[model samples]
Target: MTRRPIFNRRRFLGTAALGGAALASPAYLRRAYAQSGGEVNIWTYNNFVPEDFQKQFQDETGIKVNVRLVDDQGKQFNLLAAEQPNPTVDIMTVAGHRFLQFVDSDLLAPLDTDRLTNWGNINPTFSESDWATVRGNKWGAPILSGMEVLSYNTDYVSAEEAQTWDTLFSEQYSGQTAYIIQDMMSIVMLMMGYDGNMVEYLDDPDTAARIVEEAKQFLIEKKPLVRKYYDSGAEVQQMFVNQDIVLGHSWNGPAAALITDGFPLGMAIPQEGSYGFVYTFNIANNAPNMDNAYTFIDAVLASPEIGAAMTRASGFISTYKDASQHLNDLERKATSFPDEQLANLQFFRAEANELKYGLVDPAVEAIKAA
Candidate 1:
């Protein structure tokens, strides 16, 4: 098997496509079940687990894992919700922003911290977010985090010019800057915060709304400068690679790939900070293999090999505290855990009803039209 770089444009797909596929790495397929002698099923998206993660976990715990990849969280959540009486999946990973809706609907089971030996091993800062907790009970554990950063093509923009967000809207780069069309709230959050405290906007709906409006207006003002709006990380990477764009607001995975490939690319959190979207693992209320589920979670968290592999391949910072020791300098810099980002990490959370009722979609459409 050719070892692919951890994450690349070729692998980035839309959320809808990401959520429904069954992708098993060779290591996973060859491993035998150790303890339960039963199968454990996990449903998650791209980068949630390194390609080799399932294999490493099975080798350590003797648990056979069956992984199904889904592209869209909303679709996957609905599918799991429909399967509530008897879920086909034992554990599902959902984005942090959407976890409350799952909890309010009772689609997820409250995590039994007592059953998780590694529960204490997780840094409380990442695992203890109100967004990951429901009804004052912990329902999820952060597994991976991705942030929006300014990524630019060095072949085009000067190093100094690319260091700020202005590179994305500057006239010199007209029709050569790109941003994700779907990240309205994140874009707004970034514009509103100076160097962190992006989380504060989550507490003030009025402030968030005002920020959104300002950001929308900003985008509309720059519409002439945008080459094209993109919908997935892969798409942005493609545009950058093709030289259709000089700068963009993009995620770490794509930026890492470009840098590793020797593209004249640079990424920074910028002085104003960035927005983060985290994905977390949650148990289902109707989990058929609860013991296997807990074992699976613990096994993955316990495997330094798996954690290191994830960092190397996926560009996602593993949530387990112990995983840090296995990481190299680059890996350490990638996650928000210990140093540079510890003070700035922001999680997405809100009540289920609030999210369901929020008409942010229309607001985004209004921005595009305006």
Candidate 2:
């Protein structure tokens, strides 16, 4: 069944531009056009919501969603920080680590659960003090959540054999595994066990550095086996599908993609434990269209039709508990919305500025040098 395209920002913008009267004074017309309870500006990373869901949202709410794409969380945060009281968009989707930073700077508004009717449907995993809570209030609600798992090619090895990080460094799978270019911390956490506790490594800078050295040493020793580290999930998936990789680190989304495509791939949380992050949707403090913004969010979470479409397209666990009943068996199993798995998973904590960036890059570079 082919899905029909519903009205969206581009289509709406094109129509508005074509309306000769509206284009006469671009800035004034723009402001005037946005003043209506018909437009909601959203800032987020690409592919968070499926195109079909965007259309569904527009169709259901009569609110046109204008999404501004940013490449990374840092860039998005920087942009939002610069536009404090008067911002461009009404909402921002930030990852777990970056959300804390935004909260600390007062760049975000207190999330109003009173307006969010689906607030009760939120998974208990997100209710933790360490995850999204700031001063006893939930600042953001998770849209997509996935744990970092060991992704392996089932064709190359049995799932039992590919169960541990130690297997990646084993001689058998040498030259067939890949790692993420930017996930130095997780790699280090898995390698040294952070002196027996992963969170401890993240907390103490000196201890983290020493652990990074240990992780680097492990990686350098296994360099011959690594095909190449990848920056994007698509790249990693391509490599795995082409049979160029036998083992690597990945999240549930990519693994699910491979499985859905009939590839011989599987993902595991590992015996050492697994960590994951969530992307939360926040209303931008200075958004021009507040009513439309609320309408859009409400539609996203409350409307089962839109939520189902979003889950199918984005491969993310729907935040709405009941909406997930619409997902197929495979999707339901892979989704993070299920409290059983999400509750058991370990979440990364927010800390000082240095803890965020300082310990990661240097560790990877040093390992590459050695």
Which digits, one per residue and each the tens of the lDDT, describe model 1 over residues 1-370?
2322333444444322332222333243224335555778988765566645665666656777888977556568789878878889988987777766777778888888787766766667677865666667888767766777778766666667755676677788788888875563455446555212234445666765665566667767778888787766667767876667878888776676455444567776655456677777888888988898987876655544555555545556666667767655654554443345334444444542353225355556776776
Candidate 2 overall Cα lDDT vs. reference?
0.63
For candidate 1, the 10 contiguous residues with the lowest summed lDDT are 15-24
TM-score of each: 0.74, 0.76
- Mark the regions of model 2 whose C-alpha exceeds 4 Å error after superposition: 1-38, 68-71, 78-87, 127-130, 195-204, 335-344, 351-356, 364-370
Candidate 2 least-lDDT 10 residues = 23-32
RMSD of 1: 6.7
C-alpha lDDT (0 to 100) for residue 4 of candidate 1: 27
TM-score, cand. 2: 0.76
